[model samples]
Target: MSPVSETHLAHRLNLRLNVEPSEIGGIRHTVIQHIGSWECAAIADDVILVVSELLANVHEHAEGVCELEIEHQDEGLVVKVSDTFMTPPTLGHRHGSAETGRGLLLVDALTDHWETTITGTGKVITCTFGTPGRGISP
Candidate 1:
């Protein structure tokens, strides 16, 4: 998939969040509210889960704060989380007993497409979820 340019997005929301576990619930609520307003219920759950997973990674691995950007595209919603951590995430094979390493796996399963881009400040993990049977407006 080609990178989504800002010009093509119908709607965009950007948020800066502290890397705290307590911040996850509030951010999830915010995302759901936006999804609700967008009338994209068909992919709401998937979008929420993907956002949660990405935020959890930021809280667990990154330092300071992270930026969350959600955009409405012609095909679906694009979610990007930027953090100060320079190392990109990898999908690691973990034992069933492992508790901490499965987030990215869940992210991979839920999103239609996902990629990590290293920036000068840090890295951004972008995820795309296709919305079906619904029309998204600006």
Candidate 2:
């Protein structure tokens, strides 16, 4: 099935998929392609990591399908991942030796700003990354 939907115009892509570990790679590639086409390739690595972390969280914590919305703005790119779980994710405090619980930490380190908003059905985690000299904190 086509995970991408043409709901938004240029510079925006919306994907709704069943959250699964096997699908994460395909989703990451889709985001990378869109980032390249949007002329935001400079931040592609960070974006890919952020998307992977977010999708992993959904697959592990949430139930069923999730919606991934990516939009490229003048400053940078915005990624919003909405899942059917109402519980908001916390910034995990994993020890250096721990193997799990570093997803949110990676997101926090990569994104300029990120937040979770609760909807009637679920929660949406929005991550923003800004380009150089675009008001992103150092």
Candidate 3:
């Protein structure tokens, strides 16, 4: 018997979350479970942090509801959070006065690549993290 290859299969979880503050922890937990099911626990911790930040941003800044989609693809995990917000997230210059403005920065630092997609009804923010946790730094 041989061990399964890391990227042998694809797994996806699509979630529609009501942009409420209380359910964030639940969502995070579910995401962790899904990652575990896909046998990609190596990146589980990092994925949870990324999901938490993404959902928090949606609840705080975006309008209406949100959709979370996680997929295991091509030796990486694609985390996409969609919401009804027009403004794209930016990595602005944070001065001493800025109290809390580093969510995307953290996401970007922990993932292989990330980007934003604007749709007709809303926007989607997608972050891609390579398999087995590719060079992640806190």
Candidate 4:
């Protein structure tokens, strides 16, 4: 997928919000709206799905306040969820009739690249989804 174009991405990015389990739905809606407004509906579902999955991990495995930030950079839209969990999250596999353990898997597929980093206070999961932003890859 092409990037959204540097000009448009710069205009739509730099967003940061505090999020929790209770707030995921609303935040998801708002982010999707932003994506749609930018005429990036093609990747809207993928963006929301990845964000939800990341936040769900935060809710299940971490604690304290988590910050969700969406930014447009280089050739992709970057979504990050940071929380107070020093331990890095691990992707798991559960076969047959499993309801969980699929969030990270979904995230892995939707984003071109993703990784978790250890922050001073906790950890942050950052995933990059290729967007319509037309820019040099970074």
Give Cα-based local distance difference scores for all models: 0.79, 0.84, 0.77, 0.70
- The candidate maximizing lDDT is 2
Which model, 2 or 4, shows the larger lDDT?
2
Clashes of each: 0, 0, 0, 7
**Could you give candidate 2's per-residue lDDT for residues 46-134 as a string of tens digits?**
99999888888787888647899998888898889998899998886988999898888889999999999999999999999997778
lDDT at position 50, candidate 2: 91
**Candidate 4 local lDDT, residue 116:** 89
Which residue runs of candidate 3 sit more than 4 Å off their true CA positions?
1-10, 133-138
Q: Which rank order by TM-score, best down to worst?
A: 2, 1, 3, 4
lDDT of 4 by residue, 1-138 (tens): 111121225435433444457777876777776776666676789889998877677667775246667775546577777788899877888787996788878888887788989989888888877765553232
Lowest lDDT sum, 10 consecutive residues, model 3, at 1-10
Say which candidate scores most in TM-score.
2
Name the better of 2 and 4 by TM-score. 2
Estimate the Cα RMSD of every predicted model relative to the unseen true structure: 6.6, 2.2, 7.8, 6.5
Cα lDDT of candidate 1 equals 0.79
**Model 2 error, position 37 (Å):** 0.7
How do the residues 1-138 of candidate 3 rate in per-residue lDDT, one tens digit apiece? 011111223488877777566777777777787788888888888889998888889878885368788888657688888889978999766776778998888888887788898999779998887776353221
- lDDT (C-alpha) at residue 88 in model 3: 91
Clashing pairs in 2: none
